[model samples]
Target: MNRTKLTPLDAAFVQLESPGVPMHVAGLMIFEPPAKGGADFVRTLVSDWRKETRIAAPWNQKLESPSRWQLAPCLKTCQDPDLEYHLRHLVLPKPGGQVELGQLVARLHSQPMDMRKLLWECYVIEGLAENRFAIYMKFHHSIVDGISASVLLMKGLSDSAKDRKTSPFWIQTAPEKPFQPASFKMPSVPAMLGAANNVLKLFGRSDSLTTLRSAPRTPLNGPIGAQRRFATQNFDMTRLKATAKTAGVSLNDVVLCLVGGTLRKYLQGITALPTESLTAAVPMSLRAEGDLSPGNSVGMIYSIIGTNVADPVLRLKKISQATNVAKQQVLGLEPEMRVPYSIASFAPAIARMLTGVSGKKKPMFNAVVSNVPGGRDDKYLRGARLLHCYPANIVFPGMATSFTCYSHAGTLNVGITACRDTVPSMQKLALGMEEALCELEHGLGLEAHANPRSLDVVEAAL
Candidate 1:
C-alpha cells in the first residue's frame, strides 16, 4: 500500500473536527466561457470529467483508520473513487449573481465531508447570469495547506488561453518519490531542551507585543453554531500597492489594518465594540520555495490588529509594528524549531477545545486573517478565462470569524466566513472592508480606485 501518516500538526485538524466545526479549506473560482464554446460548455466539461473514472493521488486516497485522535488516521491510496460522489453538477437559481453564489457556498460549506470516502469534493456550477460558470472545491486540511492546494489548482490551468489540452487538477501526476512517513519526529535530547526553553520564552514574555494573553475579549470570540455565513469583497491591487508604498509597509500590513478598521466599524455599529485592541492569529506558510508537495506546512503569528485606534493611518502603523515584532521573534528561531514553537503557542487554545472549555476561557486571538498569493498573470482552463479565486478557511470553536484573501491577476479577493448566528448581516462587514480601504487611501492622501475591475460586473448583476 502506498501509505503516508499524517503529521501531528495535520492530525490535530482531524482531532479538532466536530459537528460544529469542519476543518476544511476551499476555493471558489469564477471562469468566463471560451469564445468557441457554446451554452453546453460546462456540461461538456462535466461529461469529460465524469468519463475519466481513474482518480489521482491524494484525491484517490482514504484514511487507513477512522480519523479519531486516538486512532491516528493514515492515508492509503485506494484503487477506485466514486466519481459521482466526488464531483457534482449544480445550477444557480434565479439571480445568478455573487449574492446568490455566496448563499449557495455558505450552505454547501456548512455540510461536512464524509470521512469514509475521499476528503475532497468539487462542484461545477452553471446558470450564472453573465454566462460565467463557477467551481467550488474543498479539501480537508490534513491533505494540503493553502499554498499546496493553490499549486495543485494552478497546475490544472495554463497561462496561455489557447492551450486547450490542460488536464484537470486531480489527475495531474508527478514523479513518484519513495514514501517516507509524514509523522513528526521526536527531537534529539539537546534539541528538545532547546525547544522547551524556546517555548517558555516565546510564551512567558511580558512584553505586550509578545505575550500570549494579549488578545481582547470581543463578540467575535465565542462559541459558534454549525451554520456559517460567507461574504466576499474585491479590491484593486494597484491601489493597495500604492497605499502600502505610501505607508512604507508591505501589502499584507495594509490588509491587516483594513480588516482591523472594518471590524471596529462593524462592532461599533452593533454596540459591541471592545475597548482594547483585538489580536489576530496570522498564518505564515512554512513551505520551502517551490515545495508544492501536499500536506500542511504552516505556522502562526500573533499581531495586534490596532482595533483600538480610530485613525486609519496610525492604526496601520501599529499593526505593522506588531507584525514586524512577531515576525522577528519567529525568524530568530531555527527553521526546524519554528513549527514546534507555533504549535506550542497555540497549545492552550487547543486544550480548551478538547476539554470543552473553549468559549469560557480567554481567547488566544480574536480572529484569523490569512493572505495567499495566486498567479499574477491571467490563468485559463481549457481556454476559459479565470476571473477570480476566493478562499474560504476554517474558524475555530472560540474564534468564530475567519478572513482569507487571495491575490490573483491584479485583484485581491477577500472571503469572510463567520458563525451565522453570532455575526449578523455579514455583508455589512464586506461593505465595511471597501469603506475602510477608501478611508485608508484618503487618510494617506492618495486617490482610491472606485472598485476592483473584476467585481464591477458581478456587483452590478447582484
Candidate 2:
C-alpha cells in the first residue's frame, strides 16, 4: 500500500484511450419526504458517506500480477469527509424542475472528474415539481458497475427508516475482517515465453484489433462540441421480460430491439437514414464474484444496435445476432488487454493528464446503450419509500447518450443520460421510450401496470 502505481482498473480510468468516454457512472433519485426538514437529508447522506469512505481501499498498492487486483480499508471506523465532495445543489428558477435538472446534467457530461481525489460526488437538489427533492451521485467507473452500484445504494438505505441503528458501513454484518491485496506472482519462465509468442503471433495476424478499427467514421467518432443534451425514460420491466422470454432471448435483447426501433423512428424524423444498422458499444463487466475487492474489472463490445430494421420481432433477432458476434469479438481479445487501448500508460502521469486537458480523440461508439442487471427485491429508506432510481452517466465526445435500468420491487427503473444541444429533442426520445415499451408490451399481448408518460417530452424541444 506504500506505492503509487495504477492498478489495471485505475489505469483504464486515468488513461481513457476511448473517445466520448464517461469517466464515472451515477444515479439520480427523486425523493418525496413528508416535510422539508432543513439539512436533515444532507446530514443523513454525509453520515453515510463518512462511514463508507472508511472502507474505501485506494488502488495505490502493488499486486502479485497485472491480472490480480484488490482494495484495502482501514479499521477504527473512518470519518474522513475528504474522501467525497459535497457539490453545491442549486434549485432551478421558477417552473424550472426536471427541465433545469436536464440542463445541469448536460453541463455535468461536459466536465471531467479530478484525478487528485477518488472520482465521486453527491448533490442534494431542492424544489422539484412541488415539495419533492432530488439527489445525484457520480462515481468512477473503475470501482463497482451499475448492478454493483445499485447494491451499494440499496445497502445505504435502511430497511426500516425508523430503525435508529448505529451500524458503520465500513463494518460488515457478521464481519469476517477487512481485505488486503494478495501478493503478485510473476509469470514463470514457460508462461512468459508463451505470452511473448502469442504477442508475435497477434502482430502478424491483426485479428484482434480489426473489429474495433472497422467502426465507421461517423460524426459520433470525431471531435465533439462542448454543449451537451440530456434525455430519460421509464418502462415496464414485466412487459420487457415477457417479450424477451417469448423471443427466446433476454430482457437485454428486448432493450436492444426496442432501442433499435426508437432510433429508426428518430432517424426517420430527421430524414432518410442509412440502411446499414447503426453500431453501439455495450460495456461488459469482467468482475468475477471475488474480483470486486479492488478496482475496475471491465471490457466492451462493439456491435450493431440494429437500428435500420422495421420489424420488432425481426429486429430482436438481428440484435441477438449482433450481440453474439460482439461478445465473441470481446472474448477473442487478449485477457490482459483493456476495452480502451492503454498506449498512454507508457507516459508519465503528467503527460497522461495533458491528453485530457483540452480533449482526446478516437471515440469508439456512436452512442452507448447499456442494460445493467438490477435486483428484483424491494428496498426502502428510513420510512421514506424508495420510489425510483434514475441513473445519469457522464459523457464524452462522439458519444453523448447512454441508457441503463435498475429493477426494484417488481418494477424496472430505466434511466437515460445524453448531451442537450447535440441530441435533437431528447425528451421525446424519453417519451418515445415509454411509447416504445408500450408498443412492445402490446405487441406481446401482455398487461402493463400504468401508462404513465415521461414528464413533458414535447415542450422540452422548444
Candidate 3:
C-alpha cells in the first residue's frame, strides 16, 4: 500500500468538517446525448470505467487515523475500491428540468463523505427535459481544490469533438515518464528562523494586521444548518470580456461588480442593507509556475466589493479599485511570505473553534467570491458535448453563502451555494445576477448588441 502525508492546509479542511458543514467541493456538468444512439450512453460509460480494478493513487486513498494528528493527516491506499459503492445512478421524476436537477444535487451535497473509503463519488443523472444528461461529482476539500479538480476533469475530456473513444479519467493510466518527486530534507535552523522572522514582519504591517480583525456581520453571516440550496446562471463570455476591455478592468472585476450589484438589490429587498460595504474572501491560487499537481495550493485574500454603491457603473469602478488594491498588497509580499500571511488570517476562525464560540457576532467576511479560469477550447466527454459547468463550493459556520464562476466554452457559469434557512430565496438572487449584467450592458451603451446569445432569457429560463 502507498502512504502519503497530507499538508497542513489539507489537514485543516479535514478537521474543520462537521455534521452541519460538509467540507466538500463539487461540480455539475450538463452534457448533450451521444450522437450514436445504439445503447445506453451512461451505462456504457460506467462499464468502461469499471474495466480497471486498480484505482489511481489519490482516488484509491483514504485518511488513516484522522483524529490522531492535529496538524497533519496521513493517507493509505486501498489496492481495490468497491466500484458499486462509489459509482451511482439516479433518475429524476417526470417533467424533469433544471429545478429538479438543482434540488437533487442539493440533497446529494448535504450528506458528508465517509472517511473510511475513497474521498470521492460520481453520480450519473438522467431524465432531463431536453433529453440531456448530467454528471455530479464531488471530492473532499482535503483531496483536491477547485483548480486541481478542474484539471482532473479536463484530463478525461477531449479537445476535439471527433475524439469520441477517449478513455475516462478513472481508466486512464499514469504517464510512462513520471515526474521526479522532490526529495525531503529538514530545514536548517537559520532557514527556520528566517521564516519565523518574515511572518513576524508581516504581522508588523498595519494593513495586514488590520485585515485579521473581524468584519461587520451581515444577514449572510451566521451559524449554518445542514440543509443547502443551490442556484446557477450563465453569461456570455464575449460580452463580459468586451466590457472589461472598454472599462480598463479585468474580467474578475466585472464578475465582482455583478455580484456586488446583485447583493445590493437583494439586501434592499430584505431591508437589511448594511451601510458599510460588504467584504468577500477571494481565494487566490498559489500553485507554483507550471506546477499542476493534484492537491490544495490556494490562499484567500479579502476584498471590499462595494455593495453599498447605488449606481451599477459606480459599483463597477469601486470594485475595480478595491480589487486592484488587494492585488497590489498581495503582489508586494514575497512568495514565501504569503503562506504565513494566509495562515495568520485564519487565526480568528481557529480562535472561535477553540473558545467554543459560534462566531455569529462577528464574521470574517460576508461571503466568498472565486473566479476559476476554465480553458476556452470546447471539450467533449466521450461523444457528448459539454453544455455548462457549474461549481459548488463549501459553506462554513460563519459564512453561509458562496459564489463561484467558471468560464467554459465562451460562457461564464455562475454558481451560488447557500444555507437553506439563511438564503431561502436563492433563485431570486440568481435572477438578480442576470439583471445586474443587463444593467451593466445598458450602462455601457451596448445593450442592443451586447450579448450574441440570449443569455438573460436563457439564464432565467434555466
Candidate 4:
C-alpha cells in the first residue's frame, strides 16, 4: 500500500509523545463467562485471535519514519505484524480485584509503544474473581480519539449473547475516508451581525474569555512522571437522567457539576484547593455525524467549574451558566473559525507541555474533562457478556489528571487517569465522585441512589 501523510494534528501527537507522556488511549472491558462457562474462555479467545493472520487498516498502519519523539513523514502499512507480539495474555496476582486491575492498567498505560511496528496492542487478562476476565486494548491517539477508539473496540461485538461468531476488532477494516477539513461557509450578513452582538455581550459576562486568561495553579496542573494511576467509577443512568430532568439541565451539565464537586472535595482534603473556581478544558468533537474518518478531529472549550461555592445546587447553576456561555462562543463562530479558535484556546497549554514550563506558569485549564458515547446495548464477544468498559487516556505535562467518561448499557463509566506521583492516592477521587453525586441529590431534595462499585480498595499499592 502507498504511504499516506499524517494529518498535522496526528503528527503533532506523535512528535510530542515521550516516555513521560505516552499519547495513547485505551479501554478496559470486563466480561462474564458464557452461559456454558469454561476456565479457558479467555485463553481460547486469545488462541482464536492469534490464528487470524490478516490485519486491517489503522491497526496495520505505522509511522513511515520510525523514530521516537521525532517527526514522521507519513504512515505506511506493515503487511504482517507479529501476532504473538501484538496479542498478549496475562493473569492478575492474588486477590484479583479492582485495585489489582487498576494497578496493571496504569503500568501498561505508562509504557510507550514501538514506533517501528503497528501502533496498537490487545491484552486478554484473566484471574479476576466471579469467573470474569477482561480485554484491554490501546491505540495511539494519533490514529483514533476516544470516541473512534471506542467504536472500533465495540464494532466486533454481538448484541445477542448466544452469537459466538464475532470477529476480533483488529481484523475488521476501518472506514476508508481520510481526514478532511470541514467545509468553509460564508456566514449570512445577519448571522455575522448576530455573532458580533453575542461577542459584545460576552465581554460583560463573568465567564467571558477575559475570565479565562489563566487557570488557577492547583496541584493538578504540573509536570508528570512516567508512572500513572488509573481509577474507574460507574453510575446508573436512570438516577442521573432523573436528576437532570428535575434540575432542568442537560445530562452533561450535571456531569460537569459532579466533576466540579469531586475535585473541590479532593482538593480541600489536601488543603491545596485554590480560592478561585477552577477551569476545565473540555473536548468538543468536530466530526460530523457519520464522519468516521480516522485521526483526531476535536476542538476545546473552557468551562468554569464552581469550586468556590460550597452549596451543591448553587455550584451546579454556576457551572451550567459558565458552560452555556462557552458553548455559545464556540457555536457562534463560523465553521472555519472554530478550528482556529480551538487551537488558540489550547495553544498555551500545548506550549507549556512542549517547553517543559508546565507547572511553572499559569495553566490554560486545570484539567481535561471529556465525554464520549458508548452504545446503549449490552454487547458480547463470542457470547462472553461485556459487563464494564472503562476508558484509560493520556495525561500530559501540566495536566496531571483527565476525567473521561462514556455512557454504556444504561450506565456511565468514568476513567480517571493521573500522574501517580503528582496525584497521590488517586483512588480518593473515585470515592469522592460518589459522595459528590449523593450530595447533589440531597441538595436537590431527591432521594440518594445506590452507589455503583468502583473498587474502593485501601490506598493504592506502590
Candidate 5:
C-alpha cells in the first residue's frame, strides 16, 4: 500500500477502452449447495475479508508482473454496520429460475465496476436448475481472471456438503504472493548487471518495430459496445479429447479448428477466409505455484491459430504448429521486452491515444478462444445437485465473439459470448460447432465418442 505505482488493476481500464479488442475481463462460477447449510458459506467469505485488507493494486509501476497486483478499500472500518463492504454480500431474490439468475448477472455486467474501491462483486444465487444453486463473481479486468477466479472459488466453497455449513472455508489470499520474483536468490553482481543491461539494451532497440510486428489488421478486433449477448453450449469433452489425442494435437487446437471450420462454412464465399493462419490472443496464467486469489493473474500471448488451412484435420495440425511457434516466440523474449510497447500507450499525443482508442486494430489474431480446464466431476452447493453452469463473457466492439469452456464433475460447459449485432446468429454458430465437432470425430474415424443425450436437450431448446 505504501508503494507508489500504477497497478495492473488500474491498467485494465486503459486496456478495456482500447478499440478493436476482443478480450473481456469477467468470470462465472456455479455451485451446488448442500441440503443443510448455505448461508454459512456466504458468512465465511464476509468474515475473511473483515480480518484482512485484501483489496490491493499492483505496485510494480515498472509493469514487470501482471498478477503481483494491488487492491483498494485499504482503510479499516470503524463501525460494524459500516464495516461491511457492500460489494461483498448476500443475494437472495424471491424464488426464480437459474435463467432468471442469469438475467440478473447480465444486468450487473452492463455496468462497469467502479475503480474508486474494490472493483468486484459476488452474487449468491438460488433457485438454480435441478437442486443446485450458483455463485457469480465479477472482478475488474485489472484484477482476477477466469483461472484465478476458479482457484479462489474452489477454495471458498466446501470440499464436502457438510463443510459448507462451517465458516472460513479457506484462508484469504490478501497480500497475495507476487505473481513472480526476479529469482529465488540474489544473483551475482555480474548476473544482476547483465539482467539490467539486457533490459536497457532492449529499450535501446527500436520499440516500434517489434510492436508493429505483433499488431495485425483483421475483422476480429475493434471497439466493443455496452450491451452483451450470452449463449451456452455443451460438448462431449471426452470425444473432443480423444479426437485431439488421435490427431496428435491439443483440445484447444481441436476447438480452434472447429471455430475455423464452422466460420468457413457459415461465411463461405462471403468474405473468403484468410489464406494464412489466423491469430488469437491467448491469455496465459502468470500465477506461481500456490499463490491464487481474487485478482488478475494473467498475461497475453499473441497466437496464430491456423484458419488459413481448409481441411479439418489439416487445420488442426496447422493450428497446433502455429501456436507452438507463436508461444515459443513470446516465451523466448525477456520479461521487460514488452515494456517499451506498453509505454506507447501512455504517449501524450491525442492522435496516438485516438489511434489506440478508435481505429480498427491490425489483426493480432483472427478471433479469441480460450478453454479453461476444470473438474470433470460433480460438485454440490448445499444438498442440491448442479445441473448446468452457463457462462456469459464480456463483449467489446469488432471482436464480437468470445468462447470459454470449462468442465465440472462429469459435464463440459461451453459459454459463447458475443456482440448481438455482429454474431446475430451465434445460436446457429453454436449448432454449427456441434456439427463441426462431429465432422471432426468422423474425420478421425471415431464413432464411439458421439455427443451425449444432453446435446438433444440443447438442440430441442433451439
Candidate 6:
C-alpha cells in the first residue's frame, strides 16, 4: 500500500471546506450513445469497472489527520474499495433535455463528497435526449488541480475514434511513479534566511498588496447559498483566433474581454455595475521542471476584467494590459517562491472563512477565472463520439460566481457556475458571452470577412 502526506497547499484546500462550501472541482462530459446501446451496455460497463478489485493508489486513499502537530493529512490506501459506492448510474426524468440534466448536476454538486471514503465520485447519467449520455465526476481540490486533471483525462481518452476498447481513467494504472512523501529535513540557517528574504521581497511588491485589498462590492460579491446553477456554451475556436489576430492580443486576452463585456452587461441589467472594474483570481499552473506527478501544483495571479470600461475595444485593451502586468509579477518570482507568494495572495479568502464574514462585505476579487487547455484532436470513448466537456468548479464564501474555460476539438467551451440565489439567471450571462464576442468581431472589422462557420457552431450549440 502507498501513502503520502499532503502538501501545505493541498491541506489548505481541505481545511477550507465547509457545509455551505464544497471544495471540489467537477467536469461534465457528454457522449453519444454507444454502438451496442441499451441499459445492459451501461450495466456491463459498470461491471467491467467493478471487476478491477484493486483500487488505484490515490483513488483508494483516504485522508487522515490525528492531531494539531499533523497539519498535513496523509493518504492511506484502502485494501478494498467498493466500486459500486463510488460509481453510480442514474436515469434522467422524462424529456431528458439539457435543462433536466443541469438541474440534477447542480443538485449533486451542492452536496459535499463523502470524506469518510475516497475523495471522488462518478455518476453515469443516461436518458439524455438525442441518444446521448453524460458522465459527471468530481474530485476534491486536494486530489487534482485543473492541469493534472486534464492530463489524466487525455491519458484515458483515445486520439483515434477507431479505438473503442480503451479503459476509463479510474481503471487504468498511473503512468508516472507512485506518489511518495518527500523526505523531511530541517532547513539550514542560510536556507531559512533566503526564504525570509524572498517572503519580504514578495510582500514588498505593490501588486501583491493590491491583490490583498478588497475588490469593489457588487451584487455578485455577496454571501452564497448552498444551491448552485451551472450553464455552459461553446464558441468557435477559429473565430476567436481570428478575432485575436485582428486585435493583436493573445487568445486568453480575447476570452477575458468576452467575460468582462458579459459581466458588464449582466450587472448593468440588474443595476449593480461597479464604478471600478472587476478583478478575477486567475490560476496559473506551477508544475516543477520535469515533474508530471499528479496533485495540486498551481499558483494564483489577480487580473482586472475591465468591466468599468464601456467600449468593447477599450475593454480588451485594458484586460490585455492587466494580464500582462500580472504575468510579469509572477515571472519576477523564483520558481520555489511562487507557491508561497500564491498562498499569501489568498489572504482575503482565508480571512473570510475564519471570520464567517457576511456576503455583503467586499471581496478580494469578484470571481475565479480559469482556462484549462485541452487536446486539439477529437476523442472517443468506447465507440461513442464525445460531444462536449464542460468544467464545473466550486464557489467560495464571498464569491458567488466562477468561470472555467476548456478548449477541445476546435471548440472553446465556457462553463459558468454560480450560487442560484445570487445569480438567479446564469443563462443571461451565457448569452451575454455570445453577444460580447459578436461585438468584438464587429469592433475589429472582422464581422464582414471572418468565416461564419465558427459563429454558426456556437449558435447551433447554444
Q: What is the C-alpha lDDT of each candidate?
A: 0.82, 0.55, 0.76, 0.81, 0.52, 0.76
Q: Once superposed on the true structure, which residue ranges of model 1 sit more than 4 Å away at CA? A: 69-71, 174-198, 201-210, 452-462
Best by lDDT: 1
Reference-based lDDT, residue 456, model 4: 52
**321-426 per-residue lDDT for model 5 (tens digits):** 7666545444544544333222322221123333454335443344557776676555554443445555556555445667777666656677777664565455
Report how far off residue 204 is in candidate 4 (Å).
Answer: 12
Give the 10-residue window scoring lowest on summed lDDT in candidate 3: 205-214
- lDDT for each residue of candidate 3 in 1-462, tens digit (9 for 90 to 100): 678898877887787777788889998999887677444877777777767575675677788864523666889978778888888888787557777888898888888888777888888888887678888888888878888878777777888777768775655432222355787566566655655654454333233222434255788888788988888888888889988887788999888888888888888888999987787888888776665666787877676677888777788887787677666555656555666556655555655654546545677578889998898888888878889899999987778889999889899998889898888777777777777888887887766343333343355434
Which stretches of model 2 miss by more than 4 angstroms?
Answer: 1-4, 17-22, 34-89, 92-96, 164-210, 213-219, 328-364, 442-450
User: How many pairs in model 1 have backbone atoms within 3 A of each other, for residues 3 or more apart or on separate chains, i.e. clashes?
Assistant: 0
Collision count for each candidate, in order: 0, 13, 0, 0, 39, 1
Q: Give one digit per residue, the lDDT tens place, for model 4 in 1-462.
A: 768888767777787777778888999998988978577778888888899888788788988776645655589988888988999999997458898898899999889988777889998999888878988898888899877788788877889998887788887777755666887677677666655554444324353452445478898887778999999889999989988888888888788888889899889988999888888888888776687767888867778777888998898888888778778777877765566565555555665666778766667678888889878899998898888899988888778999999889998999999998998888888887787789999999999985847445435522
- For residues 1-462, what per-residue lDDT tens digits would candidate 1 score against the true structure? 798888877887778787788889899999998998887888889888888866678778878765556546688898777888888999987548877888899988898878778888999998887789999999888888888778778877899989977667788753233455687676667766666775676555445464567877888887888988888888889989999999999999999998898899988987888888888888898775666787887878888888889999999999898888888767766666777777776677667777778777777789889999887899998899999898988876779989999999998999999888888678777877887888899999998766753353334323
Better candidate by lDDT, 1 or 5: 1
lDDT of 5 at 292: 57
* Model 1 TM-score, 2 decimals: 0.92
Backbone clash pairs for candidate 3 read none
* N/CA/C clash count, model 4: 0
Give, for candidate 1, the lowest lDDT window spanning 10 residues.
Answer: 453-462
Question: Cα miss at 243, model 3 (Å)?
Answer: 1.4
- Pairs that collide, model 6: 223-359
Off by over 4 Å in 5: 1-10, 14-24, 32-104, 166-171, 178-222, 269-277, 331-361, 375-379, 384-392, 448-462
Q: Which stretches of candidate 6 lie over 4 Å from their true place?
A: 34-40, 65-70, 175-210, 334-336, 358-360, 448-462
Alpha-carbon shift of residue 236 in model 6 (angstroms): 1.6
